[model samples]
Target: MARFLTLLVLLLAIDRAFACKPEQHFNANFSDTADQLSGTEAGNLATWVKSLQNDYSNHDLFVISSYVKNASQPGDSAERRTKWLKDFLVAAGEDENSIVSAGTQVYKPENFFYTKITPSTLIIEFVPGCPNPCCLGANPVKEK
Candidate 1:
């Protein structure tokens, strides 16, 4: 009986480590507000999160719902998340040409803010500037 129990525990550990398989999706969801996220530990990949927001904002088309497994760990900040997502989506079958990256400042004032992405956070406010849609650059930087 003791030997059998030990074998069972070993099997369980192995199963947890190798539980994930191809074609098996583990779904996750995030709230509409991503500036300050409040969700499960299974946070979403950056692209998926953005897709959800874009869809809500009527900016993106729901062409394909690609299945992508979670990374071993969630990214620490938006920049990290974006980079991780670009690589993750490509690995999960997204066309390289179809992918683009953009980020909005957390809270800063500037016409062309965030030239560097070393900082991990993503919720800075924009600096006061000329009030013009074309002049204000709210687009996130791409890494392709």
Candidate 2:
């Protein structure tokens, strides 16, 4: 019975480590040239950050930005937007080390028939992993 219980616990831990969490999609459009986040957007982000802290504290947060290529924009605009998002997440109390920006991806239409163009977007994903302090190279055993 003890052996069976130990196996069950091991299986549960393995399942959790491999579990896939849903990725969140949000519009990355800023209202002005300054790339400022509006009050509503800021409020929503803060709430999301709090949820991450409360529910997925053991997971690593990954942020990815996608944008449609435009001739008028600078080439590095997408990367800049991605960095901005990471900065915002860090500012909202998320551990900067736990947050990883996958950088920007250029959006490609599946075919010529897709006429609707979408604005830039941010994708947020959380994956199970070592939480901060432990993940930051600090010895967990010594911290206690």
Candidate 3:
């Protein structure tokens, strides 16, 4: 019995040692010309950001706004969307330091990885200190 207990302890320790942070992803979709985040979406993102701040260390939050590939717009709507997302993050108690970057990207079908491209989708990626092990390197590839 003692030997079995020792093995269990060792196994638990090993599991903890090899454990990696879970990937945190949040997304919000909007229309082509939309520049604001919905109340529910903003609230949910704020809650998630707060949780991540409490649970992890040396993590970063990235807000990437995806715009339609070939849409005609009078102004840079992507910038507006990014600003809205960052503002929501701030409202959720996230400081400016926690935000790694708020950028814009064009959505193409071929660039689909962990996210799906829509007219206007804001992707919030919470990256840990060591992102190499996140998703066990299965983010862009199928898990085998």
By lDDT, the best candidate is 3
Give the per-residue Cα lDDT of candidate 1 at 121.
33
Model 2's lDDT to the true fold? Answer: 0.57
Per-residue error for 58 in candidate 3, Å, reads 4.6
RMSD list, candidates in order: 21.4, 7.6, 8.5
Better of 1 and 2 by TM-score: 2
In the range 99-124, model 2's lDDT, one tens digit per residue, is 77665555565632354434454555
Candidate 3 — which residues are off by over 4 angstroms? Answer: 1-22, 61-65, 71-75, 113-116, 129-144
Q: Write the per-residue lDDT of candidate 3 for residues 93-133, one digit (tens) a residue.
A: 66667665455555676667655656577677766554334
Point out the worst 10-residue segment of candidate 1 by lDDT.
60-69
RMSD of 2: 7.6
**Could you say which candidate leads in TM-score?**
3
Candidate 2 segments whose C-alpha is farther than 4 A from its true place: 1-27, 31-34, 70-73, 109-117, 128-144
Tens-digit lDDT track of model 1 for 1-144: 999999999998677547622111212222322423344422554455444333332222112121112344233444444454446555644445544544423322342274532222332111212222222246522211
The model with the greater lDDT, 2 or 3, is: 3
lDDT of each: 0.36, 0.57, 0.64
Superposed model 1: Cα runs more than 4 Å off: 1-76, 107-144
